[model samples]
Target: MNHSNLKIRARDERILVIDDDLGVGECIQCMLRIAGYESAFVTTAAAGLERAQSEAFDLVVSDLRLPDRSGIDVLRALREAGQDTPVILMTSYSSIESAIEALRTGATDYIIKPFNNDDFLYSVERALDEQRMRKENAMLKRSLKRVYSSRRIIGESEGILRVLDMIRRVAASDANVLIEGESGTGKELVAQAIHYASPRAEGPFVPINCGAIPAELLESELFGHAKGAYTGAVAASEGLIREASGGTLFLDEISELALNLQVKLLRVLQERQVRPLGSKHTYATDARFVAASNRDLKQAMEQGLFRADLYYRLNVITIHVPPLRERGRDVEILAQHFIEEHSRRLGKRITGMSPAMRDFLYSYHWPGNVRELENLIERSVILAEGSVLSLEDPPAKGTTAPAPGTAGEFLDRPLPVEEYMKEVVRRYQDSHSEMELAAMLGVGRKALWMRRRRWGLYRSGDSRREGTGKGDLKRSA
Candidate 1:
C-alpha cells in the first residue's frame, strides 16, 4: 500500500505490540514505522509484559486473547506494576465484550480484528497525543514549582532569614496566612513561595489584587456570575474561589476589600464553601487561603475600614516582610543583583556601581523598597556608558555647587514644590527621556508634558542622551 500521503505526527515514539499471531504483530509494527514511530513486537503476553516492565515505551498494543494470559490480565499487571503507558487492545467481533471490559479496566483504545489501517492509526495517534499532553503539563507544573520555590527568595538578612524559616514551618500546614508589609515589599512573592512549598504545589496558585479591581466588578470576579445573572452575562461562570479548589488562593491587599465582600469572604472561610452570584446553591471548596496587605488590619478594624472577624480568620499565621531600609547590607546585595540582571537584559556591560554611587545608595532611604531599587538599577543600566554604573542626574556627595544644568543644583536653594519640580524637569530634560523624568517626579508622562507646556519648556535639540558623557563628576571610583 502506498503511504506517501500519510501525515506523521509521531516523533520517534516507542510502541510495543503483543500478539500470539506473528503476521498481525508484524503488520502493526510496520504501520507504526510508517507513522514515524519506533516499534517492537512480542509473540506472547508474558514476553510483552516483561519487556514493557523492563523498558519504557510510549504506547502498548496487545491482542484481547493470548495463549497463556488474557489482555485484561496484562492491563491489571501493568497497573499493579505502576506503569501508566497508554494501551490499545485488538479484538474480534466475538470478543467485543472482552474488549469493552478491557477499556473499562484502563485500555486507551480498542480496535476490531478486521479494523482498517486508517482507523487503527487514528486510535494510536490519539492515545499518543494525550500521553504527550500529560507529560508536558507535568513538566510545566514542575517548572512553576521550581520558579516559585522558597529557595528562590533572594536575601540573607536576619529579618529575611526569619521570614524564610516561617515560610518553611507554615508551608506544611493548611492554615490561612496573612503577610503584612509595605507596598512593593515582596508580599506577593512570599505568598507564592508558601504556596509552592506547601503540599498543594501541584495545584493552581490563583492570585487576585483586591485593591486593583473596582468594588462593583470585584464581587463578580471573586464569586463568578452565572449565565444571565447580569445584563452582560453570556455564560455560566465558576468564580476564583471555586477555580482555586484543591489549590491556593492569594488575596493581595486584602485590607482593600469592601466591607460587604469581607463578610461574604468570612462566611466562605468559616464554611469552606462558596456561593456564586445569582446561584442559590453553594458548593464546597478545598482551597488554601493566603492573604496579604500593606496596612495594619488591627488598626483598620478599629477604624471600621475592615471587618474584625474576617481579619481574625485570615490572621491565623502572620508573616511580616521587612522594609528595605530595615534590611541592612541587603541593599547593596540586591543592588548588585539588579545591576547584573538588568545589564544582561539590556545588553549593557555594567559590572558594578562606583564607590560614590554605592555610598549614595547606602545612605538613601528606600521608601519604595526593593521594587524602587530594581527600577533605578534598570534605568541606570540603560544610561550607563562604561563597565561601572555612576550617578549622573543626582550627583554624588562633597560638591559645593551642583554640575551645570542638573537638578541637584536646585537643591542648594529653597524653592516651592512647583518651582523645584519645574527646575528638576527643565535641567534633566536634556539628559533623561520623558519616561525617566516623569518617574523621578512620581507623575505620568502626560502629566510631565502638561507641566512642561505650562512652564514653556521643551527639548532644545536631541535632548535625549544615549549614555553618561563628560561633566559626570566621578568623585571616587
Candidate 2:
C-alpha cells in the first residue's frame, strides 16, 4: 500500500504482538512501525490477553507456545471476552493437526516459522483488511437495529405493516417523499425510519417544523443566511437544507408554508441550488426532501392556498400514515409498548394493563392520535402502584364513560358535535382552574376568556361563574 493510505489506516489501527521470543516480537513491532502501523508487543500471553480485553485492537499476532498458556487458549479467552480481532498464529512445529487446530480455534492464518519478510507483511495486511470489513459489517447491523426498533414507529396492525413495507422499499431510492397523516400521528418517526434505512444512513437527518417558525425567518431557516442578512445576523449560518446535504430534510406541517416561500422551495427542488439570504452567490445542495402535513394539499390547491406545482413536486412518492382509531387492536398494542417503555425508564415494575384500561384504549376515538395515547400511557405507567395498570378514568378528553345499560360498556355512542363540545367545555370547567384549562386547550388566557364570551358560558365581569351549563348536563346525563 501507498504511504498515505497506510498513514490513514494507522490513525485508527492498533495491533498486538505476543511472543516469548524477544527477537521475534521486536522484529514484528519494528516492521509494523515502519509500515505506519501502531502496535504493542508483550512477552507473555497473560499480558497480551489483558491488553486485548482492556483495549481495542485491529489485529493480533501470537506465537503458538507461550509461558503462561497455549496460543489456542489465548484465542479462546479473547473470543469468550467478545473480542473478534483477527489473530495470526506463528510456530516452528507446523504439524497438520496443530495447524488445523489453530485454524479451527479462530486463527485468521497459521504461519510456519522462518517465514520471509514479504510473506509476513502480506499476512498482516490481509488480517487488518479482514478486521476492517468485519467492523464495517457490525456497524451496518447496528444501524439496521436502530431503524427497525419499535420505538420509532409504533403499530403492528396490517395497515401499519403495509406502510413499513412501503417505507423499506422506497428507502433505497432518492425520491422526494410526501407523508400525509393527521396531526400527532408520528409522521416524523416514519421520516426517521426512512432516512436511517436508506444508503445515506450515516448522514444527518434534519427535521424542521415549518409551522412553528415565523414567516419572516422561515426562508433563512430553510435556505441559510449570509453574514448581516437581517437585523440580528451576526455571521453566515447554514440552514437545514445545507446542513442536510447528501442526507434527508424533513419539513413537518409543510402546508403551513406561505405561497411565496413555496415558490422558492420549488425552485430549490428544481435547480438543486440555494441562494442564501443577503447573498448573491448560489450554492449547490443535494438534500432529499420529505414533506409532511395534516392538511389536504389537494384541497389547499383547489382553495388557492397552496401552489399546484409545488404540491406535485413534493408528492412524487407519497405515504399515508393511518390514524390510531383506524388501526383496530393496534391501539392496545401501542399502549402496551408505551407502558413498557415508560415503566423501564421510570424504574417501575408495571406488569400489564387492566381489562377496563384495555377497553377504554380500544374504544376511544383518539382524536389526537398516537401522540396523545403515548402521553396517556406514560402518565398511567408513572401513576400505577401495583402490577396492573389502573385506567378506569381513561384520559381527560377520551369519551370512555360507561353507558347506562351495558355491564362493561365504558362509554355510550359518540355524541353530536355541539353536545360533545359542550361536554368537553363542562369537563374543563369542573376539573381544572382557568389557567389549567387554557393550557390544556393550547390557548392563551385571553383567548380562553374570549371563547367564554362567544359561548356565553359566563358573564364578562364575574370571576366565580364556573358552573356546568344545561347543554353540558344534558349531554353528560
What is candidate 1's CA lDDT for residue 375?
68
| Model 2 TM-score, all chains together | 0.63
Task: Check candidate 2 and list the clashing pairs.
Answer: 401-410, 402-410
Candidate 1 residues 1-477, lDDT tens each?
234456665576899999998887888777778778898899888999999988889999989889999887898899999788999988774465676688799999877777778778889889999999998998788667857576556888999999999998998799999999876678888988998877788889999998778898899988887788888889978889999988999999898899999999999999998888888889899999999987789999999999999989999999999988688888899989898888888888887988877876766544457776776777677766789877663322112112323434455465644676677666666666666566555444555665676676767653423332332211111
Question: Which 10 residues in a row give candidate 1 its minimum summed lDDT?
Answer: 395-404
lDDT (tens digit, per residue) of candidate 2 on 370-464: 87677677766666667777654334233222212331232245654334434445554544556544443333355456456557665333443
Per-candidate count of clashing residue pairs (backbone under 3 Å): 0, 2
Off by over 4 Å in 2: 1-138, 145-151, 392-477
Question: Quick one: best TM-score, which candidate?
Answer: 2
Kindly report which residue stretches of model 1 are placed more than 4 angstroms away from their true locations once superposed: 1-106, 109-144, 393-477
